[model samples]
Target: MQADITVDTKGMACPMPIVKAKKALDNLEPGQIMEVVSTDKGSVNDFQAWVKQTNHELVHYVEENGVFTFYVKKQ
Candidate 1:
C-alpha cells in the first residue's frame, strides 16, 4: 500500500525544508508516503540522514533543475 503527500519549499534554505518535513510527517499515519520538494540542496542530504536516523523508510529521492524531491514513508 502507498500514500503520498507533497510539500513545496522553494526559495527556502537549510533546516526550513527539514523542519517542515518533520512537521508534516507528524500529521501522517504510519505507512503513508510524504513527498517533499525543496530548492535547498541541503535538503537532499538532510532528508536522507533524517530518515536513516528516525528509522523511517525513504522510498526514493531525486534532484533536477535545482529542485530536490524526496519520497519518504512514515514509520
Candidate 2:
C-alpha cells in the first residue's frame, strides 16, 4: 500500500494540525491514505470529526511516546 503522507507535526496547535492534514489529503487521489503525527492532543478528535464531515475514512490511529499518529484515507 502507498500513502500520500505527512507526519510529525509537533509544536502545532489545534487547527494547524488539521489544516495541514486537510491540505495533504486534498492533494491525494481517492482511496489514498495520509498519516499525520501531531503533538496536539486535540488532533485526535479533530481528525475524527473531519473524516466524518468530509466523508473520508479514518483507517487507523495510535499514540506512542506522547505523539499522536492518525491514518486517514481520502474519499
Highest TM-score: give the candidate number.
1
Superposed on all Cα atoms, the candidates' RMSDs to the truth, in angstroms, are 1.8, 1.5
Please list the residue runs of candidate 1 whose C-alpha ends up more than 4 Å from where it truly belongs after superposition.
1-3
lDDT of 1 at 74: 89
Quote the positional error of residue 24 for candidate 1 in Å. Answer: 0.4
Write the residue-wise lDDT of candidate 1 on 1-75 in tens digits: 244678788899988999998999999999899988899886677779899999999888878998888888888
Q: Once model 1 is optimally superposed onto the true structure by TM-score, how far is the C-alpha of residue 70 displaced, in angstroms?
A: 0.2
Highest lDDT against the true fold, candidate: 1
> Model 2 clash pairs?
none
| Alpha carbon deviation, residue 18, candidate 2 (Å) | 0.6
lDDT for model 2: 0.83
lDDT of each: 0.86, 0.83
lDDT of 2 by residue, 1-75 (tens): 355777658989988998888878888999888988899987777778888999998888888987988888878
List pairs with backbone clashes in candidate 1.
none
For each candidate in turn, the TM-score is 0.90, 0.88
